[model samples]
Target: MVMITASGKGTSSTKGTNSTKVASSTSGTNSTKKASGTWSPPEFDESLPREVTVMEGEPAELPCVVFKLKGRAVSWIRQRDLHVISANGLTFTSDERFKVTLDNATSSFTLGVAEALRNDSGVYECQVNTRPKLSRPVSLKVLVPAARIAGATELFIRRGSTLVITCTAQLHPTAPSKVEWVHNSSVVSISGGRGGVSVHTERGGPQLSSTLSLAKVEMRDAGNYTCRPHSLTPASVTVFIVDDEVPAAMHHDSGVGRGGGCPLPALFYSALAALTCPALCPALCPALTCPVPPYPAPS
Candidate 1:
């Protein structure tokens, strides 16, 4: 006798002259096989908030998170008109107020502008380094408080002359912002809080103004000075100061002040001026006058 069994049903037997056979019925059970090579990574959620906003001199935070970030790195970048303001984990901005911060799961990059200015408003980008690069860009609009300079920004002081810089900034809501005179890279004088130095604000967005005075100016005070408004994204304006005497000779010649007669001096000065000036000569020194030769015109 022989018996046969199927996966689902019971066994059955069949008998012949010298042999018996049994077979099982295949009733409800079903079997299916799946291939092994059809696996893929999870899809990324690219529709998160990509833009942020903050007031001038205020601290702003940008958040970036990824759902499928297994082997990727996060990077933050600030995209100005034609420049990358910030990149990688470091800051590349000429402005000292911008900085980057990273978290365990999310990336929170913070930009602190001591006192926000009109120029501080722009687009900031957040990027993820993965097989397929992912990026999110946010637009930041900085609201500058009502502020203006009341006195002379450049002062011609002798070795021991007195110098004073007056800065006035006004903001809506009339919260008193900090005002200080920054000499070189360090704080030389501060006013406003307690007795250090400062000005008061009034109601209804009144214009606030203050003066940073240097009773006796010295050679050491011959660098760049900035009036910073201490607030959440503080705004600052730089004022350049030099000794009473003119520069002996510029590192490079800029033709700007070398007017009248000496082509060599003019050329030299122009070159130096071009290098020093933030913008090139074609824009700053449009009307350049050349020196005439000693010989008179033939009559």
Candidate 2:
């Protein structure tokens, strides 16, 4: 006599919906043939794995094994709505994300799920039709990963300052396979920074973090920087570089006063906001009470 075992799987196509729950069961029935002494019903093992965990959008496998099935059917069914997904290695639903494979050498039936969704989380059953029937239950759990930046979403820094960005992935099973930084939608070379660019990563519990550091940053670095992980959604931050040039409103006694090459005269006008005569506003006069400080006299 030959036994059989099979697993059931559900695929997920959407973020919050798990399309299939892969469930697996093993059979304990003995493959020994007697001289017509007695007939034993198919034995189902309940000690098999009852819980399976997988990341969303990834494939999941469920296995069901039946020993000494001896011309019996192995099938998988959803416990929530009692929907039969596969029967005797044949698919019952039109969902192409699911498929069953039966191996004669191992007497094992396996279910495969592709692109798993969040809604596919549920209990699945592997069943062997017999006199009273036999069943094994397994639970499917889906995990979703989220990405974030440790510092502010937007950043402002002076030129020549060191730049550090930390990207953290929460609820991830492991660290991202690849982490890269992008500037203004273009890939930033890890080795192309002024003071050199370096990346370091650490894992703590279920959270994984990677830090990108650029030394002696410059104005060209000012732009939208994005932290992209292969598995999670990318996070972005805007970088603004403060200029080193002084504002023109402040000038020394070199006659380079408000009206003398003072590019930002608006600073004076803004100070005399209460002046009704905009053209004759004394605020524009360098000797007058200007809003901005006058440049220091030559030593």
Best by lDDT: 2
**lDDT at position 6, candidate 1:** 52
Give the TM-score of each candidate: 0.34, 0.48
lDDT of 1 by residue, 26-93 (tens): 22122112233443443334565556555555666655555555555656665775455455467767
Question: For model 1, where is the 10-residue window of minimal lDDT?
Answer: 23-32
Off by over 4 Å in 1: 1-51, 82-88, 107-114, 147-174, 177-299
State model 1's lDDT. 0.49
User: 274, model 1: CA deviation in Å?
Assistant: 50
The TM-score obtained by model 1 is: 0.34
Query: Cα lDDT of model 2 overall?
Result: 0.67
